[model samples]
Each structure stands twice: as structure tokens, then as C-alpha cells.
Target: MEPTPRPLSPHLGIYRWQVQMVTSILHRLTGIALVFGSLMVLAGLFALAMGETSYTAFQHFSASPLGLILLVGWTWSLVFHACNGLRHLLQAAGVGFATVVFIRNSWLVIFVSLVLTILIWAWVIFGGAL
Candidate 1:
């Protein structure tokens, strides 16, 4: 018997970029960022537990420009991860399965996460209802 030829797979170039793609990729990358950010938090806690001097040293380092950038990135990562995770939970429940609804939710996840991150930072800097 003659062998049948298999159909060729579609090339990556065939697909145009979409917001859904960005949201999916960002979801994964932000998950990784959250892991590192958690480690930083743990280290901060460890420093605090060690003694006042150690905690003060950690404070100084955290106040540095590089630390501030990392802190902001970590904050954004957390917000984005949580928003995307909730979106995924809704999707698992068969919500937002329509094409238009999925795309809109993707964009909403990004926007809402950023707004939340900004709000959190503002509260942190300005003091949150304290």
C-alpha cells in the first residue's frame, strides 16, 4: 500500500498578532515575575527578623533607585497576575467564551491591572486610609 501524505502545518507567519496573544504571554511572564518578587519579600522579612541593624540595612537598599524600580515591577506583576488569573477562572467556568467577549476581557484585564497597580502605589506612598 502507498503511504498517504500528511497535511502541512500552518506557519506562524500566517497568524496576525492579537491582544489575546499579548494577554496570554503576559500572564505567563508575570507569573514568573511574581515568584521572584515573593523571594524579595521573603528576604525583607528575614532581614526584619534578624535585628534592627539588619532591617535598617535592608531598608536603605530598598530605598535605592534600582530597588524602587524592582518594587514597582513587582507591584505591577502582582496586579497583572491576579487580574489574568481571575479572567482565566471565569473562562474555566465558560464565561467570556465568545470571540468578542474574550478579546474585550483581555484588554480589560490589562487596563484594570494597571489601574489597580497605580492605586496601590498611590496608597502605599500617600498612606492608605491610615
Candidate 2:
């Protein structure tokens, strides 16, 4: 006798994407990205200790197009991660647990993070502190 075909189990495709889901995924990803950013930090510090030649090379790389892109991405990740983390902390303290409040807070995290990131980069671009 032929075996009967079984129905496939639903996976990610079954669920509609939502703000909470997006923020959750981004939180984890940005956390990982920050770890790499830290390595870049360490490299900068090491270059400083290696004296002017190495430090100047590091500065040039940081000013390059690719480096600027990475820097901007890293800055966004840092802000997003911090915002999401603060939301998580609030939830742990029994705040924003209601469905409406939860969804609203998720959007808030996204909005605030993006706004803050833009402000930060703008300051840097405009030559911070006149």
C-alpha cells in the first residue's frame, strides 16, 4: 500500500510580520553587530598605542566611504539596542504589559531610536561643538 502524504507544518511564513517581531529580530541582530563594533574600538585603541603612524592609518580608514557606512550602521544599531533594552527592562518591571501598550511601546522604540540616530549623525556631520 502507498503511504499517505502528511501536511507540512507552518513556519515563519505563516505569521504576519509585526512591529514587535521586527524590533525583536533587530534587537538580537544589533546586539551581535555591537560586538563586532567593539572589536573596531579595540583596534582603534591599539592603533593609538602603536603611535602616530598606526593611529593615522586607522583615522584614514575610519574616514573612508566603506568605513563611514559601517560607522553609521553601528551607530544605529547601538541606539536601537539601547532603546529595545530599556523597553525590555520596563516590561520586566511590569510596565507596558497590556497588548495595546506593548504594541505602542514597540513602535516607540523604533521611532525614538531612528530619531536619536539621525540627530547624532547630524551633529557629527555638522562638526559637533562649534
lDDT of 1 by residue, 21-100 (tens): 88988998999998999889898999999999999988998889998899999889999999999999999999999999
Which residue pairs of candidate 2 clash?
none
Residue 89 alpha-carbon offset, candidate 1, angstroms: 0.9
Q: Against the true structure, what is each candidate's TM-score?
A: 0.85, 0.88
What local distance difference test score does each model get? 0.91, 0.94
Instruction: Give stretches of model 1 more than 4 Å off.
Output: 1-14, 128-130
Predicted structure with the largest TM-score when compared to the true one: 2
Cα deviation in Å at residue 80, candidate 1?
A: 0.3
